[model samples]
Target: MNDQGQGITVVSLLLAGLLLYGGAGWLLDSWLGTRLFTPFGLILGSALSIYVIVKKMGGVKS
Candidate 1:
């Protein structure tokens, strides 16, 4: 895909990751009666998404 397409894909990936992980974390926190999982979930999601984006875009030369 082109740069514009890639940009959209990356953003979507990031948003999906954040929502998925964040929701999981919220659930975990609710179940465990703790408040530590939300931020961790967001961070982990962001990191994973960034890693995936870098891997996917590795072939693009600018």
Candidate 2:
């Protein structure tokens, strides 16, 4: 795939992960006893999403 395709994939993943993290956090805080910090969820989700993208992008690119 070209650069644009790769970029789209990464952006899609980031957005999906963000929505998932936010919804999960909201549900957990609302229903479960465990209280998760909102910012923490975003940070972790973004980090995880980027990690996956970088790994899939073939690690350190020259």
Best by lDDT: 1
Number of the top TM-score candidate: 1
Alpha carbon lDDT of residue 18, candidate 2? 77
Which residue pairs show backbone clashes in model 1? Answer: none
Cα displacement (Å) at residue 24, model 1: 0.6
lDDT for every model?
0.91, 0.78
Pairs that collide, model 2: none
lDDT, candidate 2, 1-62, per-residue tens: 78999999999989977777766776777786666756667777787888888788966566
lDDT of 2 at 3: 90
Give the C-alpha miss distance for residue 39 in model 2, angstroms: 2.2
> What tens-digit string does per-residue lDDT give for candidate 1 at 1-62?
88799999999999988999988998999999999999999989998899999998867487
Backbone clash total for model 2 is 0
